[model samples]
Target: MKIHNSRLISALFAIAFGAMQTVSAAAETVRSLDDLAFLEGHWRGGEDFVFEETWNGAEGGVMTGMARGVSSGELKVLEYIVVSAEEDAVVMRFKHFRRDFSTWEDGGPIILMLTDAKENDVTFSADPPSETVKSIRYFKTGENTLQADIVLVEDGEEGGFTLVFDRAD
Candidate 1:
């Protein structure tokens, strides 16, 4: 009886561990910027403010882009962004600037390394980690619409906004 019980317990543990490993493996698929080529174009939209972003097509393992936000006919914020392939991971970096071209990040650009990805959705996290902002995710909803979600990881808080861009070419 003791031998039977021990065998049963070990079998259950093995099954449970295997299930966990399967889930983890599915959640860590690597993605490339070429999979996100649909994002290449001039996109503009905002609810209370006007926002615009222009992205060049992926080439040579890198994509370059710029974003701007305006309110009441006044420039509010600007960002220079880049996405590049680094070894086996995709990396995103952004630097914020004011209307006068003054940088917002005194230390340097914010870096986000790819964590998970699928057909139209990809997630990235700050490489060295941050208290205020931790992750950013982009999901394509339609042929020309994209949604961006920014995660504030300190307390697990999240906030996001959507942008729709028409093909400018």
Candidate 2:
């Protein structure tokens, strides 16, 4: 009976330690658009295709931006983006459109909440969690370079792509 009690106590301690670790590992939510100031300015990059993004300075608790992807001198995609400070957290909402201005999403813009923030980097995840795009991250690699990562889930599999942009002339 004593040996059984000792084993049970050990298991309980392990569980408790794990719970504490999880809480510590969780990322803190960012509350201000100022934390993402590194993303400001015009950037352009791509391999076979060229893409450009321009971000305006934050004003009135909000920031606005747009991106255009071009291939062979033809516009392939256009994106409108807005980042705003909410009551509890900063949120980013964006929509994709074709050259003709047809929206990609059917219902509304995709909304992501600021989940993790660090110096020169920030990440946003779908608030309600979507089956499509899971998270978006932007980080500065150098004084003139920024990288954007988009993580997505499809058919029970997860994949992502990274776009590296450099300050445009």
Candidate 3:
């Protein structure tokens, strides 16, 4: 009788542990930009996509920010217009809002698949193709020069143009 009781308790404990692990793994599977350590830095770039920006040739801007996790960490992308020295300060720089097939993309809410980060590059990809590139590569050219290229296609054009962001210091 003692042996049987011990075996039954052991089985129950094992089942409970399995359930706990399932929940933990599920949480990890859904990735947010805040989970990316490489994205922790401050990055400034331009938005020059003709289809997405009316002032595409002018000065478009991009800003990514992260915050501490409460229930879950949150990451947000802000798009605004960087006015020239002779313009107003209320210019918007970010996109991902409209749906005229010529606006910014909706926030890429996805779970990260893999993080193949390196000393000079950090690749981030998501599930179901929410963002342009599954993985964003940050390649360093010099002390103050880096290039980030991501491909964006509207309405499923495989040979679409690449949204290139160049950093000039």
TM-scores of all predicted structures:
0.73, 0.80, 0.38
Task: Mark the 10 consecutive residues where model 1 has the least summed lDDT.
Answer: 160-169
lDDT of each: 0.80, 0.89, 0.39
The residue-level lDDT of candidate 1 at 46 comes to 76
Error of 2 at 86 (Å): 0.6
Q: Model 2 over residues 1-169: C-alpha lDDT tens digits?
A: 9999999999999999999888766534335888889888999999789989999989998999999999988989999999999887888989999988999888889899988888899999996677678899999999899999999888968898999999995
User: In angstroms, what RMSD does candidate 1 have relative to the true structure?
Assistant: 5.8
Off by over 4 Å in 1: 1-28, 153-169
lDDT of 3 by residue, 68-97 (tens): 111222222223322221221211122432
Model 3 vs truth, CA RMSD: 13.9
Provide the clashing-pair count of each candidate structure: 0, 0, 11
Model 1, span 107-149: residue lDDT tens: 8788888787778787889865765568887778787777777
Quick one: best TM-score, which candidate? Answer: 2
Give the Å error, residue 140, model 2: 0.7
